[model samples]
Target: MHDPAAPDPNDRDYPALMAPGARDLDALDARLVDCRACPRLVEWREEVGRVRRAAFRDETYWARPVPGFGPADAPLAVIGLAPAAHGGNRTGRLFTGDPTSDFLFAALHAAGLAALPHSRSRDDGQRLYGTRLVSPVHCVPPDNRPSPAERDNCRPWMARELDLLGPALRAAVVLGGFGWQALMPVLTAAGYAVPRPRPVFGHGAHTRIEGPDGPLDLIGCYHPSPRNTSTKRLTPAMATEVFRHAARLAGAGR
Candidate 1:
């Protein structure tokens, strides 16, 4: 049972409790790492940290909320659904130490965005140039699915991140339908004029949303999960092309 004195995750103002004075990404991230708002997520993350996956049994698990990776003032952002259970949840960095990262970072490197072709650990010497990676949900969910309430509970973090990134963020490549849907509202709330009826999600789909400073380009791409790649629904070449397009839109391309 949750302590009666503990803050309620369901409360609409729950985010305030996490970081009331956070005026920058670093402060926000520090607060995010300490969040224990959702009991289910908190329990699951810690359990995974303790119960050791066979391949990673010798390694210590980060087992906490994963934060966005890359420079604070990046021009382009790659938005994903959530952290992979054994990937980001273990490494404490988005898209690290998993097959999904293997596919995605290789593509990012091909597009001149990432310094390394693979993301395996927090200290992997990997770097992103003018690009940042973020997600709607920071924690890994059971079966890779976060409930609606959990999504909502985590929305504020994304919103705050976007708010801080607004000055430099010019374009975004959203991976999968879930990220596309989740980001639309956040964009709208961030002062972007998302189209009425909203744009549909599809691979290579592109739209320009007018923001207070200028237009922010949105591009859709298939998630780089093994399932999609194995089925040929998304290929390395396809993912690379999407990042290249987003880079050009954000003026970050080589």
Candidate 2:
């Protein structure tokens, strides 16, 4: 059983130095749950846990900040905007226990990034290969939206994750404009040197940012939210293609 309450050896403060190097991602992840930087996010995440949706009423909610999932040496990273209020906030894993995860993980499995096609819960035997899933905002925000201030407040954690994942990270797949926007500064701060004008976000968009570890391709894909997927704005084929792009960029076989 994956006990979320287990004390981790990797719990530590964010180092002031932002140079590229191998870092203890596990420690960083352990420290993430203790964060209370954004009061509104903290309050809302807990409330949602206390009063869960009827479907998940019998389950315990992981109201604390969610951490990234995958190996520290993963060559690819997928960044989402935030945790779904009822999804990640309920299951304690990014994109888990939600329709969006079904869409996203299906694509990832097709692209050979995930061991399974579905992400139902943290202990559901799901696994990743050469890829990690992270979000700029760890907490579940109200209406699935986190204010700009909240995003900024959470920047350090994102920066730290990127820095820790820096050594092997070769590319990233960003879902939605919000993720693209949020990742720019963190990438730059982590020594990725994002372009001066910033790359525009669009479906199938691809850009390369220079990093200390190596050049990383930033591939943009529309989020697989209910609204986008239901409307066919982002179909499985389209999502799969984007994940394939990320794999190719990371030199992962299809």
Candidate 3:
């Protein structure tokens, strides 16, 4: 588990930090209506909306915020970095309707970590059976890099989501170094201990977490972002192996 004394994840005063963000709230919806917190993302999305207009003008771009996806409650929590600006930023579902999702869900399917392999978009109607995708930053961060402030603004909601699914959260797959760093603090706060052996984040790093309710295992992987797999930093077969362990921790498969 991580200590509360660890440096605050975000730079804001704790209470003034932004509210919870589960992709299913009225207040969150309103604040996100015109959020200028990150100027870069706002500019990019607006540019996308403008240049990509024509037939796409009237279509709701989900430009506001992309919330967490997957079963609200599930056996595993897979955390990624911020939503890719053009990817989830356009679709409103994390890890959905993108190239990254194609590779990711395929591995999860083959490994039996997910119920299905196709995640075209939120309305594609595909659903996860026992797995969920929760990003530390609920919305897309510009350049795929969330400032410390934006990440901090979003942690409370991540914590809130963990509270909702923690009981069933037998395992977690943190994709990429940033996502892995984001999870450490909350895991510690929940009485989950970072492994003494210092489980390093990699394609298949594994550690144990002692939660308030019980113990859960932690796994790390390179983010399924095309930036990684396309560069060979992460491979589909390797990703499958990581999920295989996560599934086993959840008692889902052999």
Candidate 4:
């Protein structure tokens, strides 16, 4: 069923696959939009776009990979699991147009990292002062779960993101266990030495790893999913506390 003459979207060589002269943030985003490495993710994202969710019937879904949000040189970063089907997949921005985003922005605002307390669309004018948000997998996976192979396949993108962020990246707040697990290796590959026993993820877990730039502080926070929030697994205060600590570590006082 595969066409031999066509270019493979899963091509492993990043530099060769990217457009000529595509070196900046906008160019990197364009390259991300063209990724179709995972067959299942590609089909599901496109199908979700075509069918459209009931509430978003009048709106067009992004349907493609969602790139990291905020400036490339931000001092702190928040890493999430993956794009939500009706959230990032709909707004083309991480944590936008969803209840999870509402909770997240509120916490970030309280931590003094965000200018606003909500994000509805990409053009909402909400801005992050010293933070960025990215995901381990860029695509909206089926059933909100990406296969192990899929996550590994997307590592190159994450690696490039970490590289672009450069030495300015001082602290990272990992949301939930998935983000924690996904980021450990990325950090290790980026020349950071992970702990010997490996750090466990908890609501307010914290660890320090040596990064290419300098000592990178890693903080953990439970994801603000509806299930977690409704059940009180992840409270607003708890999430805000983790970010506040991260801000302090990054020397970006709130």
lDDT of 2 by residue, 29-138 (tens): 76677666677887899999999899889999999889899988888999998899888888889999899999999999999999999999999999999998988998
List TM-score per model, in order: 0.93, 0.90, 0.80, 0.92
Better of 2 and 4 by lDDT: 4
Per-model C-alpha lDDT, please?
Answer: 0.88, 0.84, 0.71, 0.85
Off by over 4 Å in 2: 1-23
> What tens-digit string does per-residue lDDT give for candidate 3 at 1-254?
32467333232443124344434434433343334455555566666645554645555566655666766568888898877665677677787767898898898888886666867767776667688788787566656777887786667667767766857778888998888888887777667777665567876888777778788888889888777889988888899988887887786532
TM-score of candidate 3 versus the correct structure, residues matched by position: 0.80
Estimate the overall C-alpha local distance difference test score of candidate 2: 0.84
lDDT winner between 3 and 4, please give it.
Answer: 4
Highest TM-score against the true fold, candidate: 1
The true-versus-predicted C-alpha distance at residue 214 of model 3, in Å, is 1.0
Candidate 1 residue-wise lDDT, 152-245, digit = tens:
7788888888878876889999999999989988888778899899999999999999998788999999999999999989999999999999
lDDT measured at residue 199 in model 4 versus the true structure, 0 to 100: 93
The Cα RMSD of model 1 versus the native structure comes to 2.7
Which of the two, 1 or 2, has more lDDT?
A: 1
User: Pick by lDDT: which candidate is best?
Assistant: 1
Model 4 compared with the native: what TM-score? 0.92
Candidate RMSDs in Å, in order, are: 2.7, 4.7, 6.7, 3.1
Give per-candidate clash totals: 0, 1, 6, 0
